[model samples]
Target: MTQQPTPDAPTVLLVDDEAALADSLALWLERRYRVRVAYSGREALQTFDESVDLVFLDHNLPGLSGESVLEELSRRVDPSSFAVVMLSAAPGDELADLPVDAVLTKPVTKRDVFDAADRFVGDAPEAKLD
Candidate 1:
């Protein structure tokens, strides 16, 4: 039997205080998925809409912490509407209880980014409904 393709491309929100890094990662991910970038957690929550499919958040940010952003996102969107992944240079237990899909350490590769994105967006056939 032939498999049905996904209805829409996954939309990723990449939040980092480093503008260059965020830009580069957004550029790289844009080739394969719809990508959005924010320099801080506050900016991320402000820029966020209901269309996001995945979120790659840096733990340390200027205005708000990544954990705060995750909390805001969790409140605003349904659990299945998007997957939140924390990306940090310093990985710790603080993120363990956060409502997130995954926690990825920094110095992340292109392959790793893509793999994580795929894991969040690829498996769910009904991800777009919400």
Candidate 2:
């Protein structure tokens, strides 16, 4: 959504029921990555593809819970294809068993976002398709 991304740059799919937070994160991440925003689980599913390198997924949503979304994603794609950072207002115990690369408690800070990005979606250039 941030212009066409540079091919080597990473892509981040940010999913949250909170439009403000989702948009704000997209604005911040756009400087470094191609960012896609989805305010609902259905949209997240529709927007995601193999090109996405990272995901910032919110655990609690109205129509489709993040848990459900994760389940669907696992079923739909290879688990190793992308990194998922699950976000939630709920306690960490609530998310301990989920199949995500990482988990962040919400009211997440800029540090939290970048820390995950730094760890999972670092500076490596994506492999170019011929």
Candidate 3:
């Protein structure tokens, strides 16, 4: 059996090559969860840490492929430590072979994203104030 991490506000790593889209999604997620953004797979890998409770990875990325990033992450993090959600604008057979927790199609709504985050992270925390 896989050991689960202690429940907490989810820390999501959002990886996308599109800077504008990535920023928009990051902003949206930041309102609820701890959000991290990476413009490429290499950057995503660099930003990855044990704190990341879930991942939203874009299928098509420049430089290293998202699959490669996932493979590397699988090797570094415990299988149960985090969940991987593959996001793609286009469908492909290659994604079927990945060991991700879930796959979501692009043009994703805020609710859909949050729902996925909640599924991985559990309940949301009370908003923090300055």
Candidate 4:
């Protein structure tokens, strides 16, 4: 039997400068995870903690880039402790050798994000797009 998450489910951070994408992803994952939104890489770093279970990070931002943010995160936490997925409109070649768990191309649908979330949060509830 699949276990349903309680009020204190694992946290998932959605870091994207695009408001619509971030908001949509948050809504999609909120049922099974506590979703936090960060509009910029700096904001993401400010809100990040050892407790975060996953991160959907956008490659481009006004200030610090997602690659830089990932680098900083690697320094502060163990690579295996949390799952970090880079979302980039550009080719993934630029992010080669980064400590992220995966790299997703931009314009990703809610289903795509949900699928990734499922890998990290086993037995998580299905994400209903409304």
Candidate 5:
């Protein structure tokens, strides 16, 4: 099972074949949102659920490509319910055929992740600095 989200914070699923990257993103993201890390497409499919408010999908995975996973997700639920951001080195226009809220280029930075979170799910309560 994925990490359970607390009542207040939104859940974020980070799917990437790169273990280091996924872990790094999860570590930083956990300060705000409830974070789940899936190292493969199969794991991502399993980890995702209704609770997820945002998904950061890496396009070029070793097994089930992000496009395929997105297709399956689209079939399982309404696309508009949760936000999907496809991460890829390819140009955004090339991915126009894909159903995604936004396309972020790799190598994504902490700022990119934070921006996406804010844009999609709004700020997590803990993200605010007094």
Candidate 6:
């Protein structure tokens, strides 16, 4: 089994309606970060807190869209403190006004995930992609 990083590892929340994808991504991220999974946008908003260092948010969700969740999160926390990476199956041009740190297209590779982590969290190594 892979070892969890140190206690001070950054916490990341994965919000996606696709259970399989979310689960797989969570497993990958857990290697170096504290990962939380929320299947719906409503759950994402409800479960998020100040402790979250980064968020991988899916654009399409059941109750609320990723944009709505980001809007609500922005009101609660300072944008600079945490990063939000919006995930979408299509172009995310409409979400340009949102205070997200980055936008990643769907079917993201492990390298893509790590690249975002490195961009927002820093100190990320170019490890092998799953």
Model 1 lDDT tens row, 6-123: 4476788999998888998887777557678999988899888998889999988867988888888888878678888889898888878877788888888887887898898883
| Alpha carbon deviation, residue 15, candidate 3 (Å) | 0.4
* Reference-based TM-score, model 4: 0.85
Instruction: Rank all candidate structures by their TM-score, best first, as comma-separated numbers.
Output: 6, 5, 2, 3, 4, 1
Writing each residue's lDDT as its tens digit, candidate 3 over 25-116 gives 88887766778999999999999999998899998897899889988998998868999999999868888888888888988888888888
Q: Which model is ahead, 3 or 6, in terms of TM-score?
A: 6
* Alpha carbon lDDT of each predicted model: 0.81, 0.86, 0.84, 0.83, 0.87, 0.85
Residue 7, candidate 6: Cα error in Å is: 0.4
| Better-scoring candidate (TM-score), 1 or 4 | 4
**Candidate 1: residue 81 Cα off by (Å):** 1.5
Question: What does candidate 2 score on TM?
Answer: 0.88
Model 1 clash pairs are none
lDDT of 4 by residue, 13-114 (tens): 999999999998987777778789999998999999998989999988778998888889888999689998889888556687777777888889877887
Arranged by lDDT, best first: 5, 2, 6, 3, 4, 1
Candidate 5 has a TM-score of 0.89
Question: Cα deviation of 8 in candidate 2 (Å)?
Answer: 1.2
Backbone clash count, each prediction separately: 0, 0, 0, 0, 0, 0
- Across 75-99, the per-residue lDDT of candidate 2 in tens digits comes to 8889799999999887567688888
Residue 52 of model 5 has an lDDT of 89
User: Each candidate: RMSD to true structure?
Assistant: 6.1, 4.3, 6.4, 4.2, 4.1, 3.5
**Candidate 6 at residue 130, lDDT?**
45
